[model samples]
Target: MLWKYLLGFYMLLVTAAAFLYAPPALGLGELSRIIFFHVPVAWVGCLAYLVSMLNSIAFLRKQKLEYDRRAAFNAEIGLVFTILATVTGAIFSRYTWGEYWSWEPRQTSIFVLLLIYGAYFVLRSAIEDEEKRARLASVYSILAFISVPFLVFIIPRIYSHLHPNPIINPGKQMEMDARMFRVFLASLAGFTGIYAWFHNLHSRYLKLKAKFEEAEKHA
Candidate 1:
């Protein structure tokens, strides 16, 4: 409980730092501030998918329904955050590119990612048997994650595009101001913390739900 309050306060500080502490990019002016939130949320989405894929592998290895449940929950969270990233990115594009969406390589790749994950839920819904659904979804989750790296990172870079260069590109030294970079790191940490808090709460809820369902089935 106390930690939740602390997290809330910390996020407030991150928000303030994004607006007040970080200087504008060389040409982007005020719009550059969006990167602090946009990049972190996108990163959290990618993290969620990675977690889901790991759990999917665990389920396949151990044949545990619990692992499948965790994978599904993580995938759901990933989808939601991916959507949020898309919307925020579109907002950024609206001002910077003079259009809401231009079907740039970056935009197209993320759209494909959304469609791929969206199909995961559809595949789940189409199956009626619990074990079979879990098995198939786990397999699909594993396969789907194989494309995440390509769609999110590789493909976007492979084509000519208008997206800004990433702050921490592996091949290049970071050119951002020290203070701005610090705030960006803080924002990333804060957003990841929020994802962890939410995931814990969601896992507890899944546990309680399973318990209730089991009780009713035996009653």
Candidate 2:
């Protein structure tokens, strides 16, 4: 698909830019390089959660099984990305701060998000009725997404922590230099393509699954 080609090219370009073009930060040195990877993964994870929330809202409004499937799959992908962000963040923190798992505000917020959505899958598995599962999962997804903003934006500001300045400042400022900015955006675009590729593949799988189940029931 087009996404596959885009993702491939993006990967190659970002790899080159990350290793070659992106300059080290004034203080962070080579460690600043992690931001190119970390920020995009974190951003896409949030994007997936937002998509899940939108689909959840659609399910509630339309009472459609398809919408619920979209919600579930997207949330699942979001949870995976959140985990990647957390792990990578911790690793980066380790190199920069001398340890992992300091229970920093940012780390704690993402950890909470992970638990919230991890329970989403659990709740679905615990329920046996298809319609009931969809209904409750939709509700839970909305509730889980409600905390995303608080965890991501509010917590970081509330606590005095070691995390560096944000890319976008509260007053709509850009924090990065020209060289860093270019690679950061490229990595973000590439990661987004990766998200679309996975989402489309998973969505198709869900459709095939429903069809197969329907055919089996008739047989």
Minimum summed lDDT over a 10-residue window in model 1 is located at 150-159
Residues 140-191 of candidate 1: C-alpha lDDT, one tens digit per residue: 9888778666676766666668888768889889878888999999999999
CA lDDT of each candidate? 0.88, 0.87
Instruction: Report the poorest 10 consecutive residues by lDDT, candidate 2.
Output: 151-160
Candidate 2 on 1-219: residue-level lDDT in tens?
776886898799898899899898888898888888888888888899889889989999999989988888888888888989998999998998899987778788778878888898899999999899999999998887776776778776776698886787887767788899989988998888889889989988988999999999999
Query: Could you tell me every candidate's TM-score relative to the true structure?
Result: 0.92, 0.90
Residue pairs that clash (backbone atoms under 3 angstroms), model 1: none
**Model 1 whole-model lDDT (C-alpha atoms):** 0.88
Measure candidate 2: CA RMSD: 2.0
TM-score, prediction 1: 0.92
